[model samples]
Target: MIQDMGLELIRIMGPFDANLLGRLLLTLVLSGLVGLERSGHERASGFRPHILVGIGACLVTMAGAYGFAELSSERDALRVASYVVSGIGFMGAGAILRHGTTVRGLTTAATLWGCAGIGITVAVGLGWLAIAGTLLFLFTLTVLEWFERRLNFGGPISRLRIHLRDDSRSVGKALDALVRLGVPVKRATVLPGAGTSALLDVELARTLSAEQAPLLARQLLTLKKYVVQVETAITPLDEPTTMDESDEVQKDDTIVPLNLKDATLLRDLNDPDEAVPGSQTERSR
Candidate 1:
């Protein structure tokens, strides 16, 4: 049975050597194009992974179509292709990520799946479909983003850097504060900081005009336990991190709101039991 199966496979696959090689090369090109756009945007899994997925899927599809084609009339030759579709999900899931309740990389994950589809399409001799699918993927990644921005759908995206205690609770509170302010968090990360502190880096969308950043900063400082020191300054969205120390503190432009000493002083001056309430405190009832 084994010898006959080998013979059947050899006989069936013998004529498609040159065509198979051509399909692989075509699959490589189509998938590579999709990956190129993703890499240009600095996505998680870029060029090489995409090409690998596309080529791998193509090979699996080929095996499903030809490797089992001559085994028996009862064999389902396309079974492996179906598995490819379902299995691609694991790879796609790796591309998806969660950043402070804002899920990112959904598009990247979808692209990986699309690349697999491109591979399978080419493997099955559906070259036109593969090419068309690739073009559509590229167009969605490139053009759809521009339309999203132009529509004011996300307003303006701004980056905020908060250096605070390394405790996870503090980080959560800071993010919660941003959310309460009504700007949706587009992305967030906790980076290592000096000593016991961590940097809470966040990207916010639909932020108010740049002029209001100080008021916003002063406001965040109210989270005394969560935020150690706070200052708010607004520069063009493209220039979020470019401010120098001198510029960040200049009272004319930035608002270096209540530092720890000031918070303490207010508590000292006001009735000690009052808890210094207009740079306000949220008391649990």
Candidate 2:
């Protein structure tokens, strides 16, 4: 039985020749085009990686076709093709990223899958199909990106955290500043601060381009009379580092409001607990 199986395997991979090299080259060029486009967009995995995926997939497909076409054995070419899909899936996973709540790298993963299909088509001598497939993939990525932006399918969103002065006039001026910009704020939250610094959350009214928001932030911060800090917050939608996660200072974070006298005392003693509410009187050791 083992001898017969060996014979079947040998018969399946018949006649490897020079013509196969031409097919492989075609696959490489086509795959490279796809990879090049991705690279232009500044993705993590770009041209070379995409080309390799396409080439590898093509080789696998060639193996499958030859095994079934020549050997007339029990092996299923379709089954082999399915394996290529699963294999490329793993490669695609490498491109994906999951942070706090947002997922990126979807486009990169999709391109990998496309390159695999092109490879398989080329391996089978279906050059036109492979070329067409690649063109379609490129159009979807490039053209669709622009179309989506024009339609505002996924508009820009920004999170702004502002520290305003404690006076009512300052708060009014801050609101007026936002009103002038015509920014449609989605949500706003108030952060309680000490005597002078009051925290405020100001969500954008509408999505602004990445550049527009920062320039606007610098303008807002310029109002020195009542404005202390105007920071553009990085939302949890993007993966945040450990240090990025800070307890939104509720009323509990401070022992008491920081004052000039408290600053002087803390500066004098290494440990200033003697002056704290619950501490005992300091004694000479």
Candidate 3:
């Protein structure tokens, strides 16, 4: 009787005997592989979430294929599979984000959607196709990225935000510095800020190289009187080290005289009625 019971247990644990469990495990391995790639990139939806999505999609597909075997003539096996496809969109939508003119997380969303497809494929017993699809997915993420970088293909553009004194002279000086450094300005906007400062938003052109980006940032810092802060998406080569506190105070005192001179010149230009000093001397002669 014990020998017969062992034989029965073997039958219960056979591949065909437990097909649902096999499908679920296949889904986990395939999705987990894709998730590992995403996790390496530090995405929002990493390993665990991708695994769950894969397993859930696999379960749904398996249930539709087997659970309704009795009603196979009356019901369509693909009904539940169709629902999984549509329902995965809601999850994909959560991964996308939009900031100003830039949109992020698109690739992550597509990856999640692909994971669901892989799960469905595995559930239908097309294991070989699912594996091939996953290998292609990884190639797109890894190899394609390397190719893009090598060919100088522009992906996401970088943004630079500058806070500076609220003066037209300051704006002109800042623009001049960026232009001189060969940094192409795609779009520039000036927004009013608190106190006497203004915010400048600049989108850079694609031609800017990573090496040149930090140099441009350092050049902007030299305009200490006009530029209060410079923020960029690119990481700086070194910490933003500024001059000594005492030196900064001394520079501030020295800058006041030049500012007064500029203010006088601006006032003279605006008020045409004010006689120019050289012109008055010439009239007396």
On TM-score, the candidate that comes out on top is 1
When summed lDDT is taken over every stretch of 10 residues in candidate 3, the lowest stretch is 249-258
| Candidate RMSDs in order | 8.1, 14.1, 13.2
Q: How well is each residue in 122-193 modelled by candidate 3, as lDDT tens digits?
A: 988899999999999999989997785445455455557777877666776776666555565656677776
Query: What is the C-alpha lDDT profile of model 1 across 19-48, one tens digit per residue?
Result: 889999999999999999989988868898
- Candidate 2 Cα outliers beyond 4 Å, as residue runs: 1-16, 68-75, 154-285
User: lDDT of each structure?
Assistant: 0.72, 0.68, 0.70
TM-score of candidate 1 to 2 decimals: 0.68
- What's the C-alpha lDDT at position 234 in model 2? 40
Report the Cα lDDT for candidate 1: 0.72
Better of 2 and 3 by TM-score: 3
lDDT of candidate 3 at residue 270, scale 0 to 100: 26
Taking all chains together, each candidate's TM-score versus the true structure is 0.68, 0.53, 0.57
Better of 1 and 3 by lDDT: 1
lDDT of 2 by residue, 1-285 (tens): 999988888767555577678889998899899898889978878999988988888888877877455457654556777899899999999999863223668989999988988888888788999888988988988998778545544454556777777666666566556655555665555678767678777665445444444445555555566667666644426531111122122222322221211222222222233464544553333
Better of 1 and 2 by TM-score: 1
Ranking by TM-score: 1, 3, 2
